[model samples]
Target chain A: MSDAERLFESLARAIIDADETAAVQLSETILAKGFDSAKAIERGISVGMEKVGDFFEKSEYFIPDLLDCAAVAERATAILRKGLAKEPVSRGKIVMGTIFGDTHDIGKNIVALFMEAAGYKVLDLGKDVSARRFIDAAVQWKADVLAISTLMTTTRGNIQNVIEQLRLDGKRESFLILIGGRAVTREFAQTIGADGYAENAAETIRLLDKF
Target chain B: MTDISPKERLDRALLGKPTDRAPVVCPGGMMNAAIVDVMNKTGHTLPEAHHDADKMSDLAFDVYENTGFENFGIPFCMTVEAEALGSAVDFGSLECEPKIQKEIFPSVHDAVYLPIGAIEKTLRAGSVIQAIHMLSAKHLDVPVIGSLTGPISAAASLIDPMTFLKQLRREKETSHKVIDYVVNQLISYAKLMADNGAAVISIADPTATGEILGPKFFDEYAVCYLNKITDAIHEIGVPVIIHICGDVRMVKPQLQKLHGDVLSVDAFVELKQLKTELGEMRTMGNLSTYLLEFGKADEIFNQAKHLTTKGIDVLAPACGLSTSTPSENIAAFTTAVKEG
Candidate 1:
């Protein structure tokens, strides 16, 4: 194999193994060796995390390893992204956050990482975000999707509030709404009028790909 | 009229005994100073100088005095085992309770080994052993139950749960090795607790149940490890109670066959369906924690009565009550068990 191909392959493995330091160092090494920055991110970091996500869905990888790999991918992506900033990017934009009154963010954070790695411009609003804030951001960013998450059964109603306000404000059709988290089921998503539901981070990517 | 001591009432319920009514079982939810004050008013005292130990016993006895519960559980928190394992924990005040810092284990391989002599020396371990000792000395009249977290759950708290779950996926063999080692440690602890004076050993493994993993992963990892621990504890002749949080309907059949004397369900599970599915194994719990925390006394009573009608062998909280849950809410649950 060519040296660039080998470098990209090694970078991908390093990200999957959750070696953030190695992933970042490898990205620079690849760039120093004259590989394209965007190609390294797309072929190395993103592809590596996608494989990690698949392993996680298949029960071959657990949460800790997935989190570690995501961290590694994020570090490597940050380094590669600086080089790509000089050029205009064509990735779709997304607004993501956990709904109001819910402090849980582990699941939401994983979904956000997957969305970001999948080449979406993620606008993370963090936890305990209100409905109005979510809609306002979606409108401001012209996001393709507004993904809402809530881990508590008590606060899952907030997802519906966001959907209702968006519809009332006449922006419902402009962006697709996806709802997910531990307490949310596919049935609950349909009941709340969300466009889709993802059981886990890997499923979120599949849903976004279809979108 | 029939004769029934608190211990005898609990024993009868476990044996499917017919009694005056369904016996109330406190599955380690009776903690906090508020509960202890009521128990002290009803003639209970701290078994030892340790505040948590004294508080646990007093809370258990208080449930009996105020609500007429049939069973008294000591060492009301699950963190004792994790603390013993050397995990740093912050015991939140009466309002906050205790919690392990989320960032305790930043990496999957950061010395995730269980400490040597962890079963014998930790403060909470000593507390549990001593609590049992004191309960046997003073409260032989009532069944004194002890609680411990299953290996997987304790390990999750010590390390990061997300990391541990990922390790299970990436390195199944290594994960099993860790689980097996931890289970051995737990079995030793369980036997020691039983020998010290605990009549029933309640195993709380909320993280290893159905909510986190589907049946495929559970059967492969959780079921076997739990069976080994339960089997060892049962060999010493102590009854084992398996408690799993979340909706465990899919795992009820597996749970029934795991050699535990009773299976405790969280409120999310439908007790009627569980009863029909398991057929003869004793089942307890299904009172919503939120209802107990936020709802009125009447709601707690009605929910407890409703669970009893579904054929629950013992009445208890679906999971540990939040520290902020009012003492009145627990009283309402115990009252329903007494009247029903």
Candidate 2:
């Protein structure tokens, strides 16, 4: 096998095992050997993350497994990004956050990681995000998708508020708004006029891909 | 049947014995029904009710009086146990439920193990106990449910949850220690509630789910720790209700082994199928809160009737109720169970 193919295999294997040390080592090896960073990210890290996503969807990997894989991919991607000649071509820019009054963000965080691994530039606004902040970030970032999440039933309404504010601000058509979480339903998504709703991290990427 | 008190009805239903009908309720903690309409109608608002025992009792009673829920569920939100364990909690407004602002520790290894009985001394725990006492005294016939955050969830609340979840595999030893400590504290807390006049204790562990922990950790940590609390509550002669949030399809076998008398599941799990699979196990819930919040009253009533026909022991919300959920919809839900 060629050197680049071997390094890609090793990098992907590191992510699947969720081994940060091996991921970092292989990332450094890729840079030192002067392989294309974009190809390394696409073939090595993204393929590994997609596999991780598959494991999660199959219930073979749970939240902890996904989080660990995300951590590994995150560290490896950081090293690979340093070797990029210019900004890599973006699939799209996405803004994500847990809606206001909700502190839970694990689901949102996982979705953000998956989107980034799939080559979307994600601006994660973090948890307890207000409608104003969500609108502001999406407008400033010129994001294609605004992904909102909330775990609590009480806070899910904040998602509707975000959608309403977008309309008032004349930016409702600018971004395709998506909502998901324990509290959000596909019916709720449609009722609130959201563009899309996904049930899990993998489905979130699939939905965004179709758009 | 007409003479059956709420407590008697619930106790009988929980035992899988013949009851006048299914006991309809919203077990507190995560499934609390202290909605805005009830609070606003009574002028006993939250953020205040969450801390003041009298207001808490009054609001819980008002929820029962107005919403058609048959029991009084104290300490509306799930943050009581987390706050008692040193996590910074944001006591949200009348409209928003409380949420954990920051965990006390960053990692399981860094967790400061408080004494087993330390939770009893916390003010929030005191308020809950006091509220249970007040409700028990004021409404002798109605059951006052004491809600607890289960061990895995309480531990996750103490340590940064992201770090805690990852450590379930990475740092098994410390994870066990932290959750064990949290479980011990929960046992004492449950006992305190029992002693304080909580007729039934409900433990809602949203973090301990088949989807999140999978079967292995769900067995090792979630089931183990939850059974510890359940056994302790059982030893106190109090009935236990265990709510496992999210999907349980992966851990259904392990879940069958839980000592909790009533198994409350999320909205998606078909309670009828669950009842058939886990025979003679009194199942509590599977009603969609989304329907209660957004759907029509007649539809909610139809769904409630569907659950009743399936012979669910305890009729309740599948999970937490939205603060903005209409009282009329909740009324329709409970009415169907009552008419059965």
Candidate 3:
């Protein structure tokens, strides 16, 4: 294989192996070799993360494995970010958070990881996020999609309140609102006026890809 | 059948012995049914009930009497174990369940191993034990199930959950030590409950599911520690109920290895199929809480009938009831199993 091809392959392997040290070393090597960092990320880390997502979809990779992959990809991305241009291209901007009154975020974290892996810029607002914060973050980030996750049935109504707040703020039309979590269902998503509902992280990426 | 009491009915059903019909119950902790509708009707509410034994007993009785559930389950939320273990907890208002505000340790390596019985000395544990005693004494015909936050979840609650899950792979030694310590504490707490008149000890470990831990870790940690607690509970003379939240398709083999008298799972699992797979196992639950929260009474009743006809040994909510869930829907659920 050509040298650049070999380097990109190594970067992807580092991510798939969830070897943060190896991924950071490979990204450093890429930068030292004056390779295109954004191309390296799009070609290498993203591909490995896509594989991780697929493994998760097949139940071959559980939460810990997915989390490791996300951690490796994050570290490698941090190294590569320095080499990219001032304005590197992204797939889209997505704002994500666990809805108000629900502190569970593992599902949301995985969703954010998959979205970022798919090349979207994700602003994670963390857990127990309020409707106002969600709307403000989406508007401030100029997001293409607003993703809300919740785990408890008690907190399910808060997702509706988020959508309602967006409408009241006159910003409902600006971004697509997506909802998912253990408690959320496709039928409930429809009932709550959510634009889309995903069963898992992979489905969320596929939905975002379509739009 | 004529002399059957709710406690005897539940005990028999849990032991896989025959009864007039399935005994519907809400195993507190995560599956609590002290919903707003019930509290409103009875005028006994949470956030206040959580800390006072008398109030807690009254509220649990209110849930049992109003919702047609057969038992009194106490300490309404899962945060009790976490709180007693040194985690910062936010005891939420009436409409919201308490949640861990901050884990005491950021990772298992950083965890401070408290003395085994430290949890028993906590105010929340005291309240729960006192409440269980009061309920079991006052409502002699009803069983009082003491719900415990299982070992894996209790360990996760002490450390940041994300960090803890990752550390289960990265820091196996410290993870085991911390979890073993937590299990010992849980045993003490369970013993305290059993001594104070708790008829059944239910363990709900929401974090230890196959989907989260995979088969390998689920077997290594979840099953191992759960069996440790279950054996202790059994030695103390109360039947143990083990509730592992989420789909168990990945961990069916490991799940079969659990020693609890009754195995409770989430709504998505097929309890009938599970019973067939694990011969002679007593399966307790599989009702969708979402339906109880959102569906019409007839729909809830029909689903309850479906589960009943499937021959599940014990009838209960698939998972935690939403605090906002309408009483009529929960009534429909319990009514279906009771009437059948």
Candidate 4:
């Protein structure tokens, strides 16, 4: 394997192993080797995080494993983010949150973390986010995809409300409305006129890739 | 089988005794059934009823009366215990349920262990207990379920969830202490509800699933602490129902350790498969709340029929019902179970 390829493999393994120090150090090592920062993230860190997401999808990784992997990716990416800030941003801006009335953020957080690694600039509004705030942020950020999540049935309607507001304001055509959560389903997405629906992180990546 | 009251049927079913029919209920807090139809029809909306015992009781009754659910569930949102404990909660408007605005502390190291009595002093806690007491006293035929957020979720509510979750691995000693303390507080809260005449104590631990904690920590924290709470609740003469969110496959081996009277799985799990694994331990649910919230009434009724035939001990939405769920859909669900 080439130097960058070898470094990426080691970095990916570090994320799979949930070793924060190893991930950080290896990430720094890659940068020192004059490796392409974006390539390192996509091929190395992003691929590593995808494996974690896959483990989570297959029920092999639990919350701690998922969180630890996300943290490792975050730690490593922090290094690359600084270097890449001056580069041309290719991945689209995505605004996401656990919709209003729903407080659960684990699922949303996982998606956000994975999206960040995959090169998307994710603007997370956190939990209990209002329909107005979602629109306001998306408009202000000029987002490509507006991702909404919720764990409760009570708050899932807020997704429709946000979408309605987007359509009412005539901005619906501008942004892709992607809805997800424990309570959100493909049927609900279709019912509410969402542009896309992902059941978990892997599906989320697929949807974003398509977008 | 004699035609028993809904409360009797639920109580008997919970205790492993024979019942005429499986009592369908959406216990308040996480599984609240106070949909917009019922609230709009009654004009006793939330953010108002969430604080007043009478309004809370009225809304609970509205759910039971309108939807044909055989029980009255109180404290319509899961944020209550956390809010009562110390966190700030944003009680949403007419169409929205309450939510935790932010956790009180940053991490387990920063946690403030409140005296258990402090929760009872909160108006929200009082309203939950009073609603349970009122329902239990007023209705002789319908069960009143007093629900509390489970330990891991409750602990997450008390602190920044992301930070607290990381501490579950990094800060082992403090994390266990924090969880143990949270579980104790829940036990005390469950006792108060039981002492106030709650027929069943329901605990929803969405954050404590094997999918989140993995099997080892699921066994270590989720099952261990839930068993503690259920053991304590059982001592108080109340059967406990435990709901774990997400697919149970990750934690399947640890399932045997969960001691709640009824093990409620989410929609992702197969109830028949869980029953086969459980081998006589009562299984409560696996109904799709997504279908309840978005699917047609006929489809929901058909799904409910499918779950009923699977021999689920209690009929309930797979998880919490959406506030916008039409009353007719909920009625179809309850009607299917009651008719069975």
- Best by DockQ, which number? 2
- Kindly report the root-mean-square deviation of model 2 from the true structure over all alpha carbons: 2.3
**Alpha carbon lDDT at A66, candidate 2:** 89
> Clashing pairs in model 2?
none
> Candidate 4 residues A137-173, lDDT tens each?
9999999989999877666888899999998999999
Lowest lDDT block of 10, candidate 4 chain B? B278-287
lDDT tens digits, residue span A1-211, model 1: 8887777888899988887667888898876776788888888988898998998787676555677688788888877766674753747788999998775676788888888887888999987799999999999988999999987665788899999999899989999999899779999999989999999999998898899
TM-score of model number 3? 0.95
- Candidate structures ordered by DockQ, highest first: 2, 3, 4, 1
lDDT of 1 by residue, B1-340 (tens): 2667777777677767786766777656222222443534654543332235665555565655664455556565556666666677655443334555453564346636665556667666776687777777787777877777876787677666666776766557777877776788788888888888887888888678664665666777778888899899878888787887766766665666666777787777877777777756688776887787779999889888777788788777777665456668878888887777
Task: Assess the local accuracy of residue A109 in candidate 2 as a C-alpha lDDT between 0 and 100.
Answer: 87
Scored against the native two-chain complex, candidate 4 gets a DockQ of 0.50
Q: Which regions of candidate 1 deviate over 4 angstroms?
A: A1-105, A120-211, B17-20, B29-52, B63-68, B102-116
Going through the candidates in order, state the TM-score of chain A alone for each one: 0.93, 0.95, 0.93, 0.94
lDDT of 1 at A156: 88
True contacts kept of 2: 0.69
lDDT for model 2 comes to: 0.90
Off by over 4 Å in 4: A1-8, A27-44, A79-90, A98-104, A127-142, A150-179, A183-197, A206-211, B1-3, B294-306
